[model samples]
Target: MTISPIAYDVQVHEYSIRVAGPDDLDSARAVMLDTVYRDFGTGYVPRWHGDIIDLHSAYVAPVRHALLVAVDERDEVVATGALDSRGPAHPPNPRWLAERYPSGETAQLRRIYVRSEHRRRGLARRMVAALLDFVAADGGYRCVYLHTDPAVPGAEDFWRSQGVAVCDEREESGQRVVHFEIPMPVTSSPVVVM
Candidate 1:
């Protein structure tokens, strides 16, 4: 099942949010890496970014996973969001929390990033809606889970506005991570622009 593209009018230009294909790998990777390096600074670690380096295997190729991108009128990718089939596990994530979302039944939101210049225009929310529509259409996901670093500007607030925060703790690296879960049976549908 395909979710219709969502269109947004930001200033005078238009943007479209839709599932990304193989052709989008470079731009989407660039957007994610740029955001990570720029926002994460010296805290960046390549080990944690293996997924971004191999976008196809991590997202596009997976039957249950999806990577959504928001592009401008020129078709330049400005933002990206993704859903992964894996649930958070121990070490980085507490086992108790991880158990709540089984591998096949959970949709984990990841790498939600919007270019600094293109934010505050509802791009993220629209992409999220598109992803949720994908999950709801798949009919396999029982819960939606995500973790965000509070260090990023507006990250905590954004997740708070979208889902319920069930865990808030500092990781071994002393970074504060907020875990959120969007209730199941997501009823959001894509708003197509004619």
Candidate 2:
């Protein structure tokens, strides 16, 4: 499933979207954790974000997984989006939702975050498009799945624009979760940075 890395550059302010490397570990982690803590509350790690402990192991090392980063002109990481081989847990999630996508066939989109200062300029969308392209090129995934909290401002709406919501329910923790499924071989071309 390994292929040459994908990279895209936008000319406006010289931001680039590309496959993350070892050098990006720290900045990528900061962008992810800052977004999560800002939106999902502080001290929510391990339970909700154990993967951040070692992003390279969770998203970069696996042949079927990927971590993409959006870096600004200064080469500072501003956003991150990753593809994970694991699917949602059954007992914690719905059996139907979990069964439809086995781990091997699913690409669970995770850590799609854009720094607050960098939002609304399509960085997130471009990163997601690149991630989708990576999955399509890998040829091992049948579908891309993701779950997001409605509490995060505009998160549900942004995902609604990208994929179809297969399940929207309230979890035992009383948190509303919306699960989305994106079709394979992305029908629309991802936005080129140019």
Error of model 1, residue 13, in angstroms: 6.6
Model 1 per-residue lDDT at 169: 75
RMSD of each: 4.4, 4.1
- The digit string of per-residue lDDT tens for model 1 on 65-155 reads 8888888989899999998988987767777888887788899999999999999998888877777777876677789999988889899
Q: TM-score of each candidate? A: 0.86, 0.88
Clashing pairs in 2: none
lDDT tens digits, residues 8-58, model 2?
444325678878889998999988888778876754468679898799899
How much is the lDDT of residue 140 in candidate 1? 70
| Span of 10 residues, lowest total lDDT, candidate 2 | 1-10
- Which parts of model 2 have CA positions greater than 4 angstroms off? 5-13, 171-174, 186-194
- Cα error, candidate 1, residue 62 (Å): 0.9
Q: Rate the local accuracy (lDDT) of all candidates.
A: 0.81, 0.81
The C-alpha stretches of model 1 lying farther than 4 A from their native spots are 1-13, 42-44, 171-174, 187-194
